[model samples]
Target: MNRRRLTRWLTVLLMSTSNLLALPALAADEAANALITRLSTEVLGSIKASASVRTGDVTTIIALVDATVMPHMNFKRMTASAVGPAWRQATPEQQKRLQDEFKTLLVRTYAGAVAQVADLSVVVMPLRASPQDKEVVVRTEIKGRGDPVQLDYRLERTSGDGAGWKIYNLNVMGVWLVETYRSQFAQEVNTKGIDGLIATLADRNKVNASKG
Candidate 1:
């Protein structure tokens, strides 16, 4: 994707993550829509207000992600889903490293785009799902200087104490984030094998980390 499109998608993804942070306090069924409506503007406002984020300060952006985004994301499931069949074949240590590096890669890759959130507004579409369903797709539209972009989220409900919803996949302009990465990751695995992919990710992360 071009940089502008990538920036818009990242902005929407960050807003979605900010919404997820409130899942624990909401009922499972109401969690998705409520959070989306409640925090969409707040997220945009925060990003616009933060000088460090707007200036692409990696440390601040990474810290914001760690604090607000990571907790509500099903990174293990996301990484596993993105890796596809390769996930089951990898060793536990490799899995850990993959998740770590993948998380770092995402945080670093989008750190600069957080600034692009300015002037954005989100509209949560009407949700369609039965109350008993464990998973649902929350559709939304992000509007700014251009046409509204379609951004959707797939969330699975969890049970037990303090349990609610966690996001596993996201779709921006009809492109599923995990699947997009999955295709690229599959290519890397096909050519370099899993270890090589891991090393590549680790090296890329190191370079991104040094940018701040």
Candidate 2:
């Protein structure tokens, strides 16, 4: 997808997450919607107010994500899923490296997308999910200029440290994030083994860091 499309949906994704620093006491059924609530505007304000954040600075965005986004995402699950079956073959260290690099890639890309957006507001749709369900799709639309853009999330309920209904994947314009990365990751794994894929990600992150 083009950068603008990625930016549009990513802005929705990133802004929707700022409130995750504190999960609600509400049940899982309501938690997703509540988490995606208008409180997210709080983060948007913080971002827009900061000159660094508005400039698409990865360092600034990384700090924001490290605090808000990291705690609520199933990054292990996200990384594993994106790596496909090759994840099983990876050593623990390799797995950790993959997760770190993948996360950096996403944060840096998000930095760019979020920077370009100056007019956007989120409207979360009613979540059609059962409390008994372990996984659910939370649909939302980005409202600003022109027609609203569609963005959705895939969250699975979990327990343990910093756990609630954590996001494992995201969907934008009918494109699933994990699946999109999987196609690219799988190709690198096939050509150069798991280590090769890790190296590629590391190289990419270094380039991104340099650009920042």
Candidate 3:
């Protein structure tokens, strides 16, 4: 696989390995590492036991993403960040469509790589954030393949009951996921406007669905 494809594969693998959305009310570092340690084994085991996942069944993978992955991810923030300044200009209905299409685009883009996550394990690195900090970067390494891939998560604390750290951005290798998408989305918005960008994502999702 090319570098981009490999990165995407690794991103999906790392993200799928842990449940970041509903972590316990602990220190950010503690919560991040604990979730990784606790869930990685179970997630990997499920993938190994499921023939559908190993064979890249799109429907199964999409369902898995929705059920297990989306809850923990702050996709509204992710979508807004990727949309940049144009997000403010988008109507509520347009914003909803954008988020939905963008979510589908991501689910379809990396869902096939679910099968590639064999014998992979994550080791959460030491945290270097002050307790008062609202946002922090949780670093980790995915071992058991070739060289360990450095994966990092940018999490922000949320307020209210049952609130905990939620992941808004991810880093695979040295690239941040939201920034990567932002560049692409910016181009679409500049040429086609917000609706155009939404249509573009919908079209891409349709093509991916057909291939599946």
Best by TM-score: 1
- Model 1: per-residue Cα lDDT over 1-212, one tens digit each: 46446644454455335533665656444567776666676677666777887767778767676787767767899999898899999999999999989888887777766666676788999889877888889888888776777778888888776477777887877888888889989998999999988988999998977875
TM-score of 1: 0.89
In lDDT terms, how accurate is model 1?
0.76
* Candidate number that wins on lDDT, 1 or 2: 1
TM-score for each model: 0.89, 0.88, 0.88
What local lDDT score does residue 151 receive in model 1, on the 0 to 100 scale? Answer: 77
Ranking by lDDT: 3, 1, 2
- Report lDDT (CA) for all predictions: 0.76, 0.74, 0.77
Candidate 2 per-residue lDDT over residues 41-100, each given as its tens digit: 566676567687667766767877777777667889999999999999999999999999
Error of 3 at 165 (Å): 1.6
Q: Write model 3 residue lDDT over 1-212, tens digit each, in one string.
A: 45677676776665665433344455344555555555665677777888987777878877777776766667899999999999999999999999999888887788788777767777878778877778888888878757887778888876675466667887888889889999999999999999899999999999999988
Worst 10 residues of 1 by lDDT: 11-20
Candidate 3, overall lDDT?
Answer: 0.77
Off by over 4 Å in 1: 1-4, 7-12, 19-23, 27-29
Higher-ranked by TM-score: 1 or 2: 1
Against the true structure, candidate 3 reaches a TM-score of: 0.88
lDDT of 1 at 77: 96
